[model samples]
Target: MSNLPTPAEIIAKANAELNQAYRALGDARDWLLSDWDVQPTAEQAATIRRMREAIGTAKDAINEGRP
Candidate 1:
């Protein structure tokens, strides 16, 4: 077994992982906002905002081929 991955294979894997992470963050943000008042801490809102910005930045990188 080898530890190294081909460039194409690495790119494919990274893209898939990034897409999944972005989707999960979006889902979490949606869930938080839908029931924001139930939370007793500001952490959830802060986290959702940060995740939204991160997703936007990730999408931009993917689109710009800078990732």
Candidate 2:
């Protein structure tokens, strides 16, 4: 048998990795907003917003037609 993953397995792995990344992004956003004590500069805030939007788009793509 070939040891390669099937398409379902590949999609599952991608979904799992994206979830981990989303969690990490949340942690970083929280730290920047609260734990760091110092306020994020305007540029930093904009970057965070962009990251959030990008992650949201990724989620939509991965979950496009699942039950």
Candidate 3:
């Protein structure tokens, strides 16, 4: 058993991690909207906004070289 990852394995792991992060952003957005009436703290609002922006940037990078 070696500790090194093959190129394919590394790519797969990176893709999976990006997918999970995207999904988490979606979940956070949904929760924020659904619970807006509860008046989330300013810190919570800022955190959600940051998460959404980070996800957008990641998506942009992924799409950059595509046609």
Task: At residue 1, give the lDDT of candidate 2.
Answer: 100
Residues 1-67, candidate 1, lDDT per residue (tens digit)? 9889999899888878877776776676566557444664588668777877876676666666535
> Which ten contiguous residues of candidate 1 have the minimum total lDDT?
32-41
Clashing pairs in 1: none
- The candidate, 1 or 2, that scores higher on TM-score is 2
| TM-score per candidate, chains pooled | 0.51, 0.55, 0.54
Model 2 vs. true fold: TM? 0.55
Query: Best candidate, TM-score-wise?
Result: 2
Arranged by lDDT with the best first, the candidates are 3, 1, 2
Question: What is candidate 3's lDDT per residue for 36-61, written digit by digit as tens?
Answer: 55776899879878877876786676
Instruction: Please tell me which model should have the higher lDDT, number 1 or number 2.
Output: 1
Model 2, position 8: C-alpha lDDT score: 91
Model 2 is weakest, by summed lDDT over 10 consecutive residues, at 58-67
lDDT of 3 at 29: 60
Off by over 4 Å in 3: 38-55, 62-67
